[model samples]
Target: MPAEFRAGERVRVRAGDPAGHTRAPRYVRGQVGRIVECQGSWELADEVAAGVAAPRVEPVYTVAFAAGDLWGEGGHEVTVDLWESYIERAERAERAGEDGS
Candidate 1:
């Protein structure tokens, strides 16, 4: 399967504050990072999170985020595999009330 997200791309970790179930870690919320690799699509781990029983096709992307971009440099550099379901475009013009990008 071709990876949905490519390298050198900045993807946003999904922010689930009101609706939808996700497996993204809280530490990664609203953070920006560059893609390292695509781990293909897999079943969503939402079942392990809450009572949400929706299985989703989640593409995994290896990402590296600077501590300054996320929290601060005082924190160590963090790398994580984020799911596509938990990923979104930064400054999403569509989600930003513009065209549906």
Candidate 2:
């Protein structure tokens, strides 16, 4: 499937904390960040980790979060490679009161 988000767009990490393995970090959940790069399509790590039969491939992105936004105060930014399923459009998240911004 085509990428749902592109570089330079704002996205919010999904906040769900489902049981089992997940690559989405606890600190980043419900946070808004900007997509810095598209890392191309790859097998979904969460599914792979769960030993799914034929994991689905999806777009991965490098997302940058301001340190201040993430942890109250800091000068630098943190970047994380996140699968498409782990994020959604920031506007949508904001409308739903999920962006914590």
Highest-lDDT candidate = 2
lDDT of 1 by residue, 1-101 (tens): 45677887777776666355555678888776678888787766765466557655667788887777577565666789877767776665633453344
Clash statistics: count for each candidate: 0, 0
lDDT of each: 0.70, 0.91
Candidates' RMSD to native: 5.9, 3.6
lDDT of 2 by residue, 17-85 (tens): 978888899999999999999999999988999999999999999999999999999999999999999
**TM-score for each of the candidates:** 0.68, 0.88
Pairs clashing within candidate 2: none
